[model samples]
Target: TVLTPRVTLQVVLSRQYGSEGRFTFTSHTPGEHQICLHSNSTRMALFAGGKLRVHLDIQVGEHTNNYPEIAAKDKLTELQLRARQLLDQVEQIQKEQNYQRYREERFRMTSESTNQRVLWWSIAQTIILILTGIWQMRHLKSFFEAKKLV
Candidate 1:
């Protein structure tokens, strides 16, 4: 089965799939994706305790494209198609690398923001604690003074 973030592209349900499965999905969203599978939930399989194994071979970005098909489609000679494929692959690698860097930057920004919030929270808590302690001590002192015990 293949899925994009907003929709399910393909699903093979119930019927037995082989040990190996190949699927390609092009992601327009730069975030995370999920590839999920589960055993049949039918009464028979559940009662029998059936087990399943799935092997996935996933290729992303430009590697997902069949260069031979592209070449044939474009009617390019061997050398030109090979060069085109290499250039395309390199371009894809650069895109993936940039995506990783973007994620890291976003994570770093979030972490810094969280750290700032925590620091401010800690400061506020400490100030409240100190003020409460002072207020309590003053109240205690007044009570003792009125009773002439201090």
Candidate 2:
């Protein structure tokens, strides 16, 4: 295994102390990608200390598509290749239901513009709390009519 400009992928069959090996390759360049493995067995009874049990399963998107191994190498006729794999799984479930209806219409227009900006900020905090309770009731009724007590 050696991807990128080094290029060597699919020659897998070596691991055998209980035997398990699988190989598949497809990547044409996107960013940060690399893989390298080597054990061409210099043999002291197969590398003197044998123990490699790797169960790496990396499946990225749309169900790791193999398309029935390309409809069994294009001979096609198992019911016309299962009706072309049911029309490519109904066009990948109609592009995942149109990307979940475009993410539920962009999360319902961002929850109706955050409930209309919290209803205009609760009507501007109830008109500044009723004009600060009518300016503190005309400043305690002009300080109780200038101290005449009423």
Candidate 3:
């Protein structure tokens, strides 16, 4: 089972297979994802001391595409296949750029929010200091006048 960054569960292999398996999935959203593997064996007592070993080979971006398969499936000539590869590369670059833009926008919004909060806090502190000074001066003036030391 694979859990996407959005927390959506996708079952790569519902049934138990051999020790080795290959699975692939396309991610529509850009974020961190989780992969989980567990044995669903009915006969747990068969091998109580047996250990399960998993080897994962994850590929992303341009490497994820099986170029030979694409070429054969599309019936593309050598030139056509090369052009298709270039196009795929360009498309991947565009997607990466869009993701970078999204991250930049989020960072900008966070920075602006923090700056606004700091500004407001400084203004509040200034106002409090001014009020305190005024109160102290008035109290001292009354004390001096009462003691005939004005």
Candidate 4:
């Protein structure tokens, strides 16, 4: 289901049995997002009283699957479902690999730029040191000549 751009969600539920609930949220942006909902009951023992486990899986953009009902209505075979899953996995893997490459390229460019700046700064410092040394030597020579020591 395509949700509106921005909407508020209010969820209220009470657990009676050892049942579980799952909530899935998806957005348009690509990448992985996790939305979880769990029950916190301190009155009951850790292993006792009914434990409520809520597993939430959210897939965004093209990763979202909205054709399960349609596939079921059409009575798709097991092979069809397996093939669809494989294709989706392949596509997701390709997108992830491309994103990783983009990050690496950006990191490389930033490193090169920083290295260049450091090299220029070092060169400037060397030039300033040389100029200062020359000026000090000239000033010392003039002082000695005025005092007739050289």
Screening candidate 1 with a backbone cut-off below 3 angstroms (N, C-alpha, C), the clashing residue pairs are none
Residue lDDT tens for model 1, 1-150:
434444544342223344454544566666556666665445586457766556677767776778889888999999999899889989988998999899899899999999999999999999999999999999999999999999
RMSD of 2: 13.4
Stretches off by above 4 angstroms in model 2 are 1-63, 68-70, 73-86, 93-95, 131-133, 147-150
lDDT of 2 by residue, 12-94 (tens): 33333324467765554322345655555565754666665467677744467777787779877789877877776787687
What ranges in model 4 sit over 4 Å off? 1-63
Query: Which of 3 and 4 is ahead in TM-score?
Result: 3
Best by lDDT: 3
> What tens digits encode model 4's per-residue C-alpha lDDT throughout 70-139?
4798788878977877788888788879879988997999999999999999999999999999999999
Ranking by lDDT: 3, 1, 2, 4
Report the error of model 4 at residue 57, Å. Answer: 7.9
Leading candidate by TM-score = 3
TM-scores of the candidates are: 0.67, 0.39, 0.75, 0.57
Q: What's model 4's TM-score?
A: 0.57
lDDT by residue for model 3 (27-89), tens:
776777777777666666548876666788888888898889998898889999899889989
**Candidate 2 overall lDDT versus native:** 0.68
Better of 1 and 2 by lDDT: 1
Better of 2 and 3 by TM-score: 3
Off by over 4 Å in 3: 6-20, 37-52
The residue pairs in collision within model 4 are none
